[model samples]
Target: MKALSTALTLAMLAGLAGCVGQSGSAASAWYDGRDAIPPRGDRIYICHAFGCALKTPVDFAGRDIAALRRILAEGRGSPAAERRAIAKAVQWQERRVGKIVGSDKDVGGLDMQNAGVPGQMDCIDEASNTTSLLLVAEARGLLRHHRVESPVARGFFLDGRYPHATAVVRETASGTAFAVDSWPEANGVEPHIKPLAAWFNDYPS
Candidate 1:
């Protein structure tokens, strides 16, 4: 039933404004019509309650930037090392933003039980938020080996898979995109970062 709910939630959301999931330009159209990404290290919008039904503004102050810089510096040597550091950076971001929005208590994945509630994040929410955080790191010049790309989605309900989305990063050297997915885990835990190709066909099994 939970799986059904997840598919329903995603399908229902995609129907709104005829917006598809967060992939390419579609992500902007879905979230508050935010067609343009804000300046780096600026105030960010947190998407929760599924389909970005709730958007809360959160600022990344100097302290947060400092922490991000320090964390990302650890991965400057190699793309592999940077990805590990990216996970740490994302974990920190989840904790930081969660405290302000009370999303620290949010359950992971598609949670109809917390629908319209204060702190539930489906894959869409997770994808958007993680993308925003990654942009901040990129803007602050904290990212060295990988360039943050637009968020992407996979699956279609008719294909026997639930629609899902995730943030992405591209390795500058190899041009390989990796999925940064947070919806499968609890808040503050690092998302599963995997090759985007693998993520698209076989995830959330």
Candidate 2:
């Protein structure tokens, strides 16, 4: 009877694996269909767990730039403070996205359960979304101290860590690089912003 139970458990596990694989395949197809355009002008494409939407959910358009500028103005005196402000602004926008998509209850970190479900973002979704937000901020002239850079990645299988990625930025004067990653936090929480070197060494908390 114990052996039979073990076999049943294995069957159930195999079934779950098949489901996950199918979900991942569908997600890949959806990702492939996305346009490579960056967010700009009065409208921005907000990406979430499922896919991208070209809607102004967050006040990231037009006069909202002033609000972003205000949030950023608080840290204008120092690079560290500016980065903190950027993180805070990003968190605020993330919360808005959460509400817009009705995905405010997503798990805090690395939620793989129901992997392709709408509103349940994975690292790819988070990184892409964060990069979009940075680009929009840069275009609006809201970022004074730093410039957006291409997204950086680490921890592929060869690195002995699970694959991960994050949005990156470079300070205009100091030329230091920083990673702005929001994947590990729950909705409405500030993202982790740290030096690129330290970010490379970080593991999910």
Candidate 3:
């Protein structure tokens, strides 16, 4: 199944490349125009503008969910712990997805090649994937202190900075929203988890 998915991804990428070119705007639009594909039971699909990787999708059954739960366990009752768990879970997903898509060495931040590379992900990809992961965690009741929210975006005309987007989680007690931004970090690294206010003021580092 994994082999078949890989073949399909390669084929779709070949076709999409011609339509989207290497422009980041085109790539971003291509991603935004697509509907969010939800997880089917224990399986979740990871999307790239070039094509969706893991045709069979990643299965979150049994050990996978257990691993996630173990990560979440580290933060059990506190928002800070939940944030750490969120970061760890996201990094785990990044590593798994990167391996499946063969983009394990992808660098962080704005890279021109990301617009064209099959496995390299842009901010849209990161935000979408993170939201999906958070949603999955929520469904499994692994999150106690934080609840996943819709992906939030800022910048471009709104902030005079480059367009950026991230997944958000709201603390149940304080109702404070924190941005879980994975695009500015290298693959498999912990993402920037900060208050939405601070995240808005942040420049890429």
Candidate 4:
């Protein structure tokens, strides 16, 4: 709904650049596909029900934001440490928001048993939600070593795999990219933070 055409156009260009897409509005467009309201300020749209087919708006109070700041403050040592804090923050957000959005029951990857139902999240949903969480942290100046980036997608239906996407971040010092993927973990579990290249090479398991 917000910049759908722009996202689609960027995705097309990313495919031409080299296989599907990588980081940026393409991921934002992924959310737009389901009419998600982008994360901004203290309000975020928690995406569930596969492909962000459903979005639940949750607002953070001052206490909630303070908790995030404290959680992230522990990672100021290095990029690697910050990544860990990021995973924790993402988990915290999931657990806290799950109560409101019901994603607490969400299993990693596709919850085939509950496809298109609330409490489940597919890659698209995971990627979009994770990206939103990262953006929230980044916007508040909690992240210093890395920056939230556009969501990245890999594998076409014909690329020996189904389409999949993940949230991404780039190291400010070295520009190294990493995949912040939570689709492989159950709700409230720490997400997998791996280099983007490695994530692309391996299956999204």
Candidate 5:
């Protein structure tokens, strides 16, 4: 189910970006650890993307994705490391989820369907928003692979432009975060970020 969701979300994203109809079948995963990666310091911070700018108290420079990958991989090696690993994962997820609005009003009624479903044509922003959430859930370990929003997304819409849904997972101490995804053309993990508060708010107990 998760993998299917991820594929659908990506397909929607490709469609939105005008890549769905392209001839080249390049299989690109969400995070390639290529570029645009956040910092990997001991105390990691997740920033939110807002209105043509990346917003957050956290500073992201002198950080490397490889280091973060090592930390998360090593951290996941033990039960004692779960909290920290989860925290890092949540932070990572937030970086992507925050860019998208998850309120019921942001995307409701016809606007959401028009934006979400595939058709003769569509816009990139809508598909980008949809894929961002699923990728975050995948990064946070909520889902094994990537996933897509069901045709019927029951809860929450953004400020009347986009419809949003969340990936459900078992309760964890790390809490949930809202992830934001940057366009693929931008390159690397730098395109993602999430806010701590918004993340948990998006996923209720």
Candidate 6:
């Protein structure tokens, strides 16, 4: 719910930017009649790390949950299978938001490359509601498919602080750990494990 709230706030701000809106729906507003969301199986949710003043990832035009979940379920037993699942999840999320371009080999599109722009113009709205739900669903689905026994926390990086809902995965086995954020440097890219005090000393409770 905290993540959704953060996402909704971002979406409302983007809507105020005067570039996104449609039928009073944030999704319709951002797409502007373009039918370009990628396959559902590949979409991965991203959030803003610095603040909520970034563009949101457009939801690809025709993604269904079942399809998205199925695609995210790929990569059962390969080296970096978790990585593959992460990549595919991001692609699915990016495409759904209509941010991806052809042959990019990455999700979150130009935003992925820049790492600053949010996933969509209406990301906040979508995230708090549809997008966030989809992302969380995918994340859970991944755990189920991989038989991963660790808990994954989901939350938002707001104003350089991680707030709202978050999952902390504490398992001895090596599992994937990364932040899905608007900062170009962190777009589906995992960073070295540093002490929480190092990056978020002023983190909110």
Per-residue lDDT of model 5, residues 15-133, tens digit only: 23422222111113211111112223322222223211221223323343443454456455443353344345434543433343221123221343433322211112322333433
After superposing candidate 4, which stretches have Cα over 4 Å from the reference? 1-30
What is the overall TM-score of model 5 with all chains considered together?
A: 0.24
lDDT by residue (77-104, candidate 6, tens digit) is 5424543554455445444444342212
Q: Could you tally the backbone clashes for each prediction? A: 0, 0, 0, 1, 32, 32
Q: Write the per-residue lDDT of candidate 3 for residues 82-145, one digit (tens) a residue.
A: 8998999999888877877655877788785657576777776677678778777888888999
- Provide the overall lDDT of each model, using Cα atoms, as 2-decimal numbers: 0.77, 0.65, 0.70, 0.79, 0.31, 0.34
What would the per-residue lDDT of candidate 1 be over residues 1-205, giving only the tens digit for each residue? 9898777777554643223323442244544443323333468888887767778888888887889899999999999999999999989989998888889998876567887777688877887788888877777788999887767666666566666777888898998889999988889999999998898888442
**Model 5 error, position 117 (Å):** 26
| Candidate no. 3 TM-score | 0.78
Whichever of 1 and 6 has more TM-score, that candidate is: 1
Task: Answer with 5 or 6, whichever has the higher TM-score.
Answer: 6
For residue 46, give model 6's deviation from the true position in Å.
8.4
How many angstroms is residue 189 displaced in model 4 relative to the true structure, after the best TM-score fit? 0.5
Write model 2 residue lDDT over 44-145, tens digit each, in one string: 555665334332244455556776778888878888888999898888777766767655775667676746666776555666677777777777677888
Q: Which stretches of candidate 5 lie over 4 Å from their true place?
A: 1-63, 78-84, 92-164, 167-205
Instruction: State which candidate has the highest TM-score.
Output: 4
Q: Write the per-residue lDDT of candidate 4 for residues 1-205, one digit (tens) a residue.
A: 5587557555644533322354553346555555666887888888888767788889999999999999999999999999999999999999999879988888886457777888689877787788887788887888989987777777654445556677888999998999888888899999999999999887633
How displaced is residue 166 in candidate 6, in Å? 12
Residue 60 of model 2 has an lDDT of: 59
Provide the global lDDT of candidate 4 against the true structure.
0.79
